[model samples]
Structure formats: structure tokens, C-alpha cells
Target: MILQVDELGKMHSGKQEQVLFAHVSATIEEPTRICMIGASGQGKSTLLRIIGFMDREDQGQVLLQGKDRSKWVPREWRKQASYVAQQPVMLAGTIEDNLRVVSTLHQSVFDEKLAKRLMERAGLTEMAWSKPASDLSGGEKQRLALVRSMLLRPAILLLDEVTSSLDMHSKQLIEMMLMDWHEEEETTLIWVTHDMDQARQCSSRLWFLAEGTILEDVSTVDFFEEPRTQPGRKFLGIQSVRERKWSGEGINYV
Candidate 1:
């Protein structure tokens, strides 16, 4: 397994006691693309942070490459994976500087040519190399963020709504780049998204989350074909199918 999350749970310190999932378990294999779908504020971003090592889980273990992550240094684990957020967080520098920071982390000799190629692949070739990152448009910023992540060539990628703010063309470009990366490098992708259509198009598996727990975990086809949980069916707008009384191992629609 490329990544394993066992019995993951998180709770904030408050009287209301908001719990973000309990007993969440998942394993990602090489070249696997998983789309986590749910309503807004369902802790999808929180789950990504936990997996990415940006935030620690209140309980449970995250294993990368079959080694318990807690046993490893946090910086070492971060070197093995890259987390890209919805908004691009660019530093006060040029695009070249941004790419260099990540490339130098793993490579002894940073190759500017390779960096330029990757940026071009991400649709950032038009004067992006020399321009200030702060001056780029929203789509440009998103692509630049992806290019920065790609420079690290991480085995696992944690994406939190990376495409939520892009236009149709930019979104398609990102989709193509992700598919190419998955096929070429066997990278494992875990993305949190609200767009079911986009999720169906890009991911091989789906994990549906709601109220701090996973409602269903299944193949993307099964999710759309016969959602096993009422929350899953309702989220997918398959009320008619639920009324037909199809039985499955997961939760039943009421």
C-alpha cells in the first residue's frame, strides 16, 4: 500500500464537541485516484490535512509505505508527499524561485530545464517562468501550485479542492495533467471535491463523508449505480432507486 489510514478521528476542544470522523480507514495503492465527496464543512479538508501530515489526528495511525508515520520525523514525511490547497500560497518571489524551493529538497542538482518542462506541461508556459507569482491570475496561480507540487515528484498527493476555483478550460487542463501523472508515475491521488460529475470523471474510487463519518466506500461505478447508504443515495439524487428497495451491505435509505 502506498498510504494507509487506520481508525482516524479528530475532535476539537469545545462544549459542542465537533468530531471529524471516527474509525475512518483507507488504503491507497499505487496509481490509485480517490475522490472524497461530501457536503461543505464535512471535514474533507481536515481529513486531507491529517493524511498530509499538516495536522495530527487526535487518534489513529497514518502509515506511508507500510511504516508508521508517527515513528518518522514530520519533515521527512512531508518530503515524501505534497499537499496542495484550494488557494495557491505563493511566496514573495518569481515562479522560478517557487519551483526551485521544492526541487532542491530531493535533488542534488536542480534542473531548470526540467522545471520549465513541468511548468509547460501544467499550462504555465506563457511568461509564467519570469513573472512574479503574486501577479498571476486565479487559474495561473492554481496551475503554478500544481507545478510546484509536481516538482517534488511525491509518491502521494493530497489535494484539497484544488480545482474548485478554476474555469472549465483550466479544470480540464488540470484533469489531463493529473491523469497523465497517475499513468506515468504511479502517483496516488486523494482529492476532496464537491463536484460529483468531476469526481465521477476523474476518480476510480469514492469515499462519501457526512457528519464526521464515512457513509460509503466503494468503486465509483457502484457509487453511481447502487449507492448502499441513504446518505450516499440522497447525496447522489437517486431517490427513485432507493424507493425501489434494492438491498446492499451499507446503510439503507429511510
Candidate 2:
């Protein structure tokens, strides 16, 4: 397994203690494309934060490459994985500058050629290389965030609704980029999206979260065909056959 979470639990202390997830466990093997789907505020983002190490779990252990992460340095883990937030957080400079600032890898390790290639692949070759990040379109900014994270060539990538606000063309571009990465590079991808159609396209597996728990973890084929849980069925209602067909593979609801 490339990544594993065992009996993970987290609770936020606020006006009321909010248990984000409890006793949650999952494994991500190489080349796994797992899509996390659920209603808004269902803790999909929170789960990503926990796996990305941005937030600590109240209990349980996270293992990466067979080693317990609690015993290892977080900075070391970060080098092996990266998270792209829902919103792009760019710096006050050129696109390259923004990447440089958020880059955790060495400058010598940076592959300028590969970066440019990824930018081109993401459909931003025109304005991505030299344009100031502040002036880029929303889709361009999202693509930049993706390319910046790819600079690390991380073994695992956590994406939270990276294409939520994009136009259909932009969304298709992002989808194709991710599909290429999964097929060509075998990158372990974990994405959270409210778009069921997008989720079905990019993920072979589906993980449904609701009320701070993973109600279903199954193949996307099975989840859509015959959802085993109430929440899973409810979430599926957000997309129709026409939209699910965008995956290019008809849903095998059986």
C-alpha cells in the first residue's frame, strides 16, 4: 500500500464538539484513483486535510509506504505528497514565482521542462509560463495550482474540488489531465468533488462520506449501479445518466 489510515478519528472543539470522522480506515495502493463524494460539509475536505497532514487526527495512525507517519517528520511526508486546495493561493508575482514559493523540493530537483510540459498538458501553455498569477482566469489559476503541485512529482496527490468553478471546457481539460496522469504516471490520486460526473470520470473507486463517516467504499461501477447505503443513493441523485455518461463508460449499475 502506498498510504494507509487505521482507525483514524478527529473531533473539533467548538460551541459543540464536532466529530469529523471516527474509526475511519482506508488504504491507497499504487495507481489508485479514489474519488470521495458526498453532500457539502460532509467532511470530505476534512478527510483530505487529515491525509495531507494539514490537520492532525485526534486519534489513529497514518502510514505511508509502510512506515508510521506519526513517528516520521511531517516535512518529510510532505515531500512525498502534495495537496491542492479548492481555491488557488498564488503569490504576488509571476506564475513561476508562485510555484517557487510553495515548492518544497530543491531548485536543482525542479524539472523546468517537465513543468512546462505539464502546463501545456493542462491546457495553459499560452498564459501559464510567463503570465502574472494575479491576472490569470479562474481555470488558469486552477491549472497553475495543479502544475505547481506536480512539480514535486509527489507519489500521492490530494485534490479538493479543484474544478468546482470551471467552465465545461476547462473542466474537461482538467479531467483529461488527471486521467493522463493516472494512466501514464500511475500517480495515486484522491479527489473530493461534489460533481458526481467528474468523480465517476476520474475515479475507479468511490468513497461516500456523510455525517462524518464513510458510509460506502466500493467501485464506482458498483456504487452507481446499486448503492449499498442511503447516503450513497442520495448523493447519486445529483447526477443523471446523461451526466454520468460523460465518463465515456456507461454506468454498470449492477
**Top-TM-score structure, candidate number:** 1
lDDT of 2 by residue, 183-250 (tens): 88778889998887887778999888876778788999898787876566656664445556776566
> Which residue pairs show backbone clashes in model 1?
21-212
Off by over 4 Å in 1: 13-15, 242-254
Tens-digit lDDT track of model 1 for 1-254: 78888999988544267676788988876668989999887788888888888988998888998999758787667766788988879978987877787756655466778778777776677765668889888777877888788767788888888887788877888888888888998888888888878889989999999767877879998898868887787788776544655554345657
TM-score of each: 0.90, 0.87
The lowest-lDDT stretch of 10 consecutive residues in candidate 2 is 101-110
